[model samples]
Target: MVDELEKAKPIIIKRVKRKGHDFHGGSWKVAFADFATAMMAFFLLLWLMGNTSEDEKQAISGYFHDPSGFQEKAGSSPAVIGEGGANVAVIEIETIQPETDDIESEISKNEASNKPLSEEELAKLAEQKEIEKLKQLKKELEFLVENSIDFSQFREQVMIDITPSGLRIQIVDKDKRPMFDSGSAEPKYYSKTILRGLANVLKQVPNKLSVTGHTDATPYVERENYGNWELSADRANAARRELLFGGIKEKKIARVEGFSSSILFDQQNPHNPVNRRIAIIVLKRSVAENIEKQVLGVE
Candidate 1:
């Protein structure tokens, strides 16, 4: 029976079965994607080269070479074009020089029309400059006294202003806090600190200085020829010596005058404590010249 079954199956089971090929491998898709990417990169490069301005191109080139944008030495360098692979080219471009004929002609015309200032005009200009400088000095002194820790406490006592002569810095006396001992030219401890600071600032300026001393109108008995005038004069000279010791040049001192109660700080109250003060005047060069001329009777 087994032999008969085998023979029958062998004769009948001759059917054909067809199978489709595996998905044509996906490798072809990968190759197509790579081709598209390369084409996109090529087009982008073309757009950049065509549209970029000269300065933009130069800046990009500089960034590539030095990402940190720091130079070893400060100097001018020649501009560069794209310097790589396909666009590598050493272009030596010359800068366009601006025409200066019009400028030169304008300058020449101005020179021809200009006239030298007369003596009076020159003097007026000098006075204007001096006034401006004095104003600046006054502002600086005010700032120093107002801001400094050591000097700020004396802000009320220190007065800085621009005068007709030049800048005037005054350290006036308060009833309770006198800069000097009563009827004495000796400076208090705080007064020395202020003077030293002032000397340091005064040394920076080229202007000559004048120190004046004033006294209150209270009467004092003359003893051994020592009176208000001598006391005021001695005090002014004493302040001058302190300034010199604190580094102020002796040559910068133009004058030291003592007006014993003659110039009252408060005209209404002759015996006001504010009248007893030390006055430091920064004299402008022009003002000093005027004073000199007056002294010599040359004006």
Candidate 2:
């Protein structure tokens, strides 16, 4: 029995060294490498936080406070808030100041107060004023005619009519009181009296006046020396001078036109006596109004 036991113990006498590759396992080394990478990332985040500005910090905080906080993970910048969170800029809100009720009220009042007069109203007022002026002028002229000694001598030539243009006072041919010389540009004696009366009446009214001269169609044999055109122009100028002398302002006279058988009373009857005369016209105020508007650049 002792010899059999010695034989069983002698069966496992050879012991060999284990291989180095078989003893090593990589699980602990991989876990240590992962832990080192995590520590490096954590330190980088701390360095970035230390360098951040106040505005950047506030912006980051605002991003976190947003309702969809996780949406900023898509690399979008957050809504910016100013320093100390006191001055925050909202992108959706406009910065303009609202107009007050007082300002609107003042604008409305000015618009209403500066409204312009209508065309019809202006025309009616102008016509009424012109008619009133004409009536007053007629009364004064009648009074002067009544007081004058040679009123009847002036009667045959003197005439008054209210045309569409306003007033037309004609002084036609008379024997001793010819408005102009028979064959010259010179005016006669009694013509001055008629002009003085017309000027006196014109000065009282504010309406503008135009003095026009007309001549007979008879072509003079001495037309080469003194033509009808020259005679007509001279007569109109003479009338203007007489009017100025009798107290009518030169500014009140708009213009003086001379027509040599051009604008006759009877176009068919060229030799009519009534066609040769001087006319005094009281122009409508609309002419002055239009000129004023043109100068001021108003519509």
Candidate 3:
């Protein structure tokens, strides 16, 4: 009975020893390896954060949180490189700032330098200059007509308006003194004197000038052969000829338009005496340039 008991005890001890050898716990080694790997990752993150911009760092932080639009690319390790020349890990920099600030600086400079004048400001300046020039011309015309006719009446008939295009000097016709002899294209003696004075003033200015003739809607009874169009055109041409005679260069005359009653002062009252008139249009250089381009076939 003692010998059987001893044999069973030895067998049980041998089994226990075998079991201990087979199931040797490795939890300490696994914990040590995990600690080492975490330390390496921590250092790598620190190094990458040092190299990346603020925007890029924020992007990477966002990617880790959601990874919705993040894509992994094959590249160099943001950490230490392996001796075998294979990249084991990578750090992505998503938002890189532009390096050249010159473009931004140049845009700022251009904005500062090339500011344009407002429409109101431009209009005010043009009107002021035009008014000054017209006042000077008015004085000269008053002096010229002092001998023959009452200059005060002429002043009331003539008016100068500054427009976006340029200065427009209008000679309005009335019952007392019509600019043209009733339906005829011929200028009255006083009207010729006034036109010569206008030409003399125009010759001093450097702007391009245009002569236009306008007539009231009253039909001609005596000169039925020459309609309003022909009379208007002839009157404009006569004024142009007088301007040339008064020392104005023939080339400076831009155009002569005969607007027979189409552009009346008062369309409802077509027989208004003011509708029968002559207009001297002074064009600015900018306006002349646009006209010149059209004439030369330039786009």
> lDDT for each of the candidates?
0.72, 0.64, 0.66
Cα lDDT of candidate 2 equals 0.64
lDDT, candidate 1, equals 0.72
What clash pairs does model 1 have? none
List runs of model 1 lying over 4 Å from the truth.
Answer: 1-112, 294-299
Q: How many backbone clashes does candidate 3 have?
A: 0
Error of 3 at 39 (Å): 99
TM-score per candidate: 0.61, 0.53, 0.51
Candidate 3 on 1-299: residue-level lDDT in tens?
99888878844344444345533678877888999999999999899988975434444555555443333322232321222222212222211112224334544565688855466755555545554554454444443343223243586678776666666788889878898888777888778867876675577666788899988898765665778888888899988888888778988888888988878977889999999999887776556667779789997
Candidate 1 per-residue lDDT over residues 1-299, each given as its tens digit: 99888878744566688775655778778988999999999999899989984435655665476644323311243332222211111122221111244334544665688955566755565566567666766655665575444575688999988787778999899979988887788998888878877886677777888998888898656477777888788889888988997789999898898888888999899989999989999887777777778878997
In order of listing, the candidates' clash counts read 0, 0, 0
Best by lDDT: 1
Q: For model 2, how does the per-residue alpha-carbon lDDT over 36-69 read when each residue is reduced to its tens digit?
A: 9999999988997899644355556655465353
Decreasing TM-score order of the candidates = 1, 2, 3
